[model samples]
Target: MQKLKDRVAIITGGAQGIGAAYARAMAAEGARVAIADILDGTSLAKEIEAAGGRAMAVQVNVADETSVLAMAEAVNEHFGRIDILVNNAAVYASLQLKPFSEIDVAEWDKVMAVNVRGPFVCAKAVVPFMRSNGYGRIVNISSGTPFKGTPNLLHYVTSKGAILALSRALAREVGGDGICVNTLAPGLVLSEGVIQNTDMREKLTGPVLASRAIKRDQTPEDLIEPLLFLASDACAFMTGETLVVDGGSVMH
Candidate 1:
């Protein structure tokens, strides 16, 4: 049998980039996927359908409880259950380069609302359903920046750190209920968000050859396996753990 046969999944930020890659991979793995983004998830849904997978699209704002709840409802109403949730929606603001002292408080809040609050809200809405089902997989997307000590990423990096903490505590609390929570911290995936900075791009690609055991440029494809491991039944025993998907970049 397929690993996730007949399962239902919801992935935020499912409209583009890494989130979209996860959506495609989940669908390919035999899960009925709900591609939920801040806007139309239709294109991803179309792709999944074209591939003969059961899929749906739900426009969602993960930071808003109301919007998150609506997304949850749509998943349950459409698929009758929620077996997995990939909390991948995040905002990579171009204005984050400003010095810490020059940062606007409102702008900081805006980033937090999406990067931190969004995942929290989405996870909260699914907990009741997951707990009731007594079986669920939750994959929270994190980044290497939390430990890499990268400069000029105070807003984005801080939220990823919080996600790691959230995944840990929630996994401990829910493990007995048959629900698993984990975070996948992807490093230098050549993401659309990172493409804005030429220096950052080279910075990401350079350290691997200079420092790691294996030197290779990281891409969205590099993360598919890690995502699948967390989302599939193969990872039942793992919880509260983080899988770093960098190309030997930030070795522990």
Candidate 2:
């Protein structure tokens, strides 16, 4: 039987890279996915549909409450109910690594707005519908950088750390409503953006591989099963937990 049959999922940042991978995985498991992103995800949605899965693309700015609210409403309307949300949007990959002191204030604020505040706004917008159905799963995408205290990306690391705390607190508040909120923290993934960026690959990949117990480049495929478990009924008894899937890097 399909684990997510008839269920609806909204995946922010579903336009490309890891987020796009998540959309494809979820849809394969029978989810009606909303490819929600600031970028256009129309091609991905159509691709999923072509592959016999149901999907729709929506443009959204997750940091904006109004935009998030509208995206939630549209997904709910199109699929009839919202059962899962994957908060996978963030400003990473394109970031230039630099000392904290040299980081521009505007750049810092933009990172916080999208990476930290984005999940907060998305949860606020979608929780109502989840509450109405008395069922929901929220998987907040975080990073292992905070745990490792990775340097040169202060704003990104700080924002990701906030996601951990946010998931814990939100889980507590919504556990009674049958909503499970959890964080999925991955190490330096070689996503499309990261692959295309010579700086990120050359500077980060070797050190990341050296640190991992498995000692291989982490791929989007490595995250699929963990993500599925977290976003499905299998995770019913778990909430407010961070599942780190980075080839055993930063084990705690």
Name every residue pair that clashes in candidate 1.
Answer: none
Q: For residues 178-239, could you state the per-residue lDDT of candidate 2 as single tens digits?
A: 99999999998989999988988899898899888998999999999999999999999999
Error of 1 at 152 (Å): 1.2
Q: Clash totals for all models, in order?
A: 0, 0
Q: Which stretches of candidate 2 lie over 4 Å from their true place?
A: none
Cα lDDT tens digits, model 1, 16-114, are: 888888888888889999999987889779889998998999999887999899989889999999999999988762544545777678878988899
- How far is 178's C-alpha from truth in model 2 (Å)? 0.4
Worst 10 residues of 2 by lDDT: 1-10
Q: Please report the candidate that would top lDDT against the real structure.
A: 2
What lDDT score is found at residue 118 in candidate 1? 88
Over 4 Å off, model 1: 93-96, 196-211
The TM-score of candidate 1 is 0.93
Cα RMSD, model 2: 0.6
